[model samples]
Target: MNHPATPQEQDYPLSAVPLEARKSLASMGLVLLGFTFFTATMWAGGSVGTAFDFQTMLLVLLIGNLLLGTYAAILAFIAARTGLNTALMSRFAFGQVGSKLSDFILGFTQIGWYAWGTATMAILLVKMTGLSQAWEMPLMVVFGFGFCISAFIGYRGLEWLSRFAVPAMIILIAVSMTIATNDGGGLAGLSAIVPSEDMSMAAAITLVFGTFVSGGTQATNWTRFARSGKAAVVATLAAFFIGNGLMTLVGAFGALVYQQADIVDILVAQGLATLGILMLFLNLWTTQDNTVYNFAVAGCNMFRTRRRKLVTVVGAGVGTLLAVLGMYEWLIPFLILLGTFIPPVGGVIMANYFVAWRARYPDLETASLPAFNLPGLAAYGLGSLAAYTSPWIAPVVGVVAAALAFALIHVATVAVKERRAEMMKPV
Candidate 1:
């Protein structure tokens, strides 16, 4: 297994992982753990904790992460087998030009997240330093550019940042939990407490699952290097189930005990400022790098070019501008209103690989693809609609609906084509 990615290879995001370049499970696990362990996960957990009882929130997170892990694992397995990233794989189901739509979806969402995350860190940093509001814009620029430098360096930088940040996050959360527990009257008190507000079980599940569905859909960007399908599965499972779940627990713990959701804020409240600053930087930096890196991958694929570094710079500039303009508020409502749209992409890709194409992609060097794969596009639409209107689990419904719709449409359309050709034969 290739342990470290080549510098030249990381610069170009248009190609699939070569046969000799697959990586070991340990490497992939650590890399993804760095990504899955995020501040946003903890923030979502705070909302979860305030909405439900201790036991209920625990159950919701456990079930939600498992569901999230399942689809991510599917994408990871395909990536390991085909050595293609999600944006590239979308071409199989979405057609050559049509796949650009996927590129825009993935790229735009990541850019949105990048802007929101950078601004969030800036606001928090200003508050943490007790600085005046004037420092916020300066800090936002400083942090945004500083983080994009790592992204400009590409995957190696992300892996390095992840390796250190993942463990640091664990230590910070452990210490933060210990302080919060002692000051808030311990386990008995936490268990005895009630939710501050009412939240439906369905809504809680949606929040937990929807928070990361966009990123999870692009798991192949990180998992394409896995040495085998086993490596991909284990990496995805550990990252999603354990790393993600831990984030929620950390958030819930702080929110329930101290009414604070942001872990940095929780630590700062407990007089852990120095450590909070460190944890806060590492947490936001790793996520920002991953977000921007994925955005670059999508951008390069959309343009069918190898100039990912140029794309990286462009993406960072746009995201930084959006951040300064306060796009987070706009993204929040859009993210929820269109939450079901992203999950179907994973579903369509999975359906195309596992069922339609029999788990294999064509030669990346020369493959003639359709101009538009209507079956897949239609299936994605249906799946997203099901998610939006259904009373059941939205993400789950979206995935199943899209997968089934693609398979059915592909089979039926092929059969009709064959029959028409047979009837139109020279008689």
Candidate 2:
């Protein structure tokens, strides 16, 4: 397959992607597809299945995905317009040095997720193959490093894998979904079925939103490669709304019918042993590849180094250790917390890019930025607090609160700067 040339170390963390290196719409779409078609998402679907009636489940999924998709689309637009990854763009709002905080949050979260995915894959492998328990750690290492190498290759590797894996995954997932649907007695039967567990509508929405909010916020990492804004929007919409939505529905379908949320579990229960293994492998690989890539990008930003490949390797090491420690079982609560805190970063980015900078950034190569950006800092803090305390939709509250806080703080800063300039001129 044709690919972009390897990015040199000098250009790894700081520079905008050169226009010539931008990707076509189809390629970007495929990459996003690889990300959204994750086993974790299907697992989240299982959460959906236990909770609500069919109509409620569908409503929750649609509303939740719409929120996730809309948030991601805004980030995608800025990324395409600026050709900057989320970490780089964050420097605009968070300051050159202060951006490290955002980097830490994003990078650390991705590593945690990588660990969770690795653990999940390892256990699933052992279960499916009936391998000895002794092999689980070794399997985790193998899968972790395997996915790590793909990210080490950077965007080109993602493209190659997505090109092959995305299509294959779609077919395999379709088969699973169809089998589950048929077993549950088709569309009519699914609707008529009663829910086994009582899940509040708010909780269901939170489940869907929490599943991908962090990933969605970091979308600029991939969308920055899009050739145009339209491509970025289209790719994000297709992946977050359509691809991620399907994942939730399939999980819900299984839950409502078979009382299973995991697509792998559903597949195994359905007697599609071979297909189950294939889906499990592909699903984990696609998600972990992107997760590692996210970690590498954030690591590069945090350390202010261009050693992306080295960072990728280190991240794999850390994630593998966590997986061996059984992080998968304990990471769900952390992920939900992540959903609340992460959206505020997106809101801050939106305000900084659209309202403050008005879609233009001074040349980052030589542009002067503050040591810190207090407005962004304040907004993020307040947003997090509101999410924790408010009874409303936490993701929405966090995002809207942050955006408004940034805007207000920005206006105040500009006013103060203007007054100082006027006084100096008169004197």
| Top candidate (TM-score) | 2
Cα lDDT for residue 381, candidate 2 = 87
RMSD in Å for model 1 = 2.5
lDDT of 2 by residue, 1-427 (tens): 1224355553345568778778888888888989998888877878888777778888999999998999999999999998888898888889988889899999888898899999988888888888998999999999889887777787778878888788877887678778878888988998888877776777667778878888998888889888889899999999999999987877777777888666667778878778778776877788898998898888888788778888889999999999998887875587578868888898999999988999898777777888798898888888888877767678888899999999999999899999999989954
| TM-scores, each model vs. reference | 0.95, 0.95
Each prediction's RMSD over C-alphas, in Å, is: 2.5, 2.7
Candidate 1 local Cα displacement, residue 338, angstroms: 6.0
**Prediction 2 TM-score vs. true:** 0.95
lDDT of 1 by residue, 320-422 (tens): 8888998645643545643578888999999999888898777865888997889989998898899989787788889999999999999999899999999
Candidate 2: where is the Cα deviation over 4 Å? 1-7, 420-427
lDDT, candidate 2, at 45 = 77
- State candidate 1's TM-score: 0.95
- Which ten-residue region of model 2 has the weakest summed lDDT? 1-10
- CA lDDT of every candidate: 0.82, 0.84
- Give me the overall lDDT of model 1: 0.82
Model 1 backbone overlap count: 0
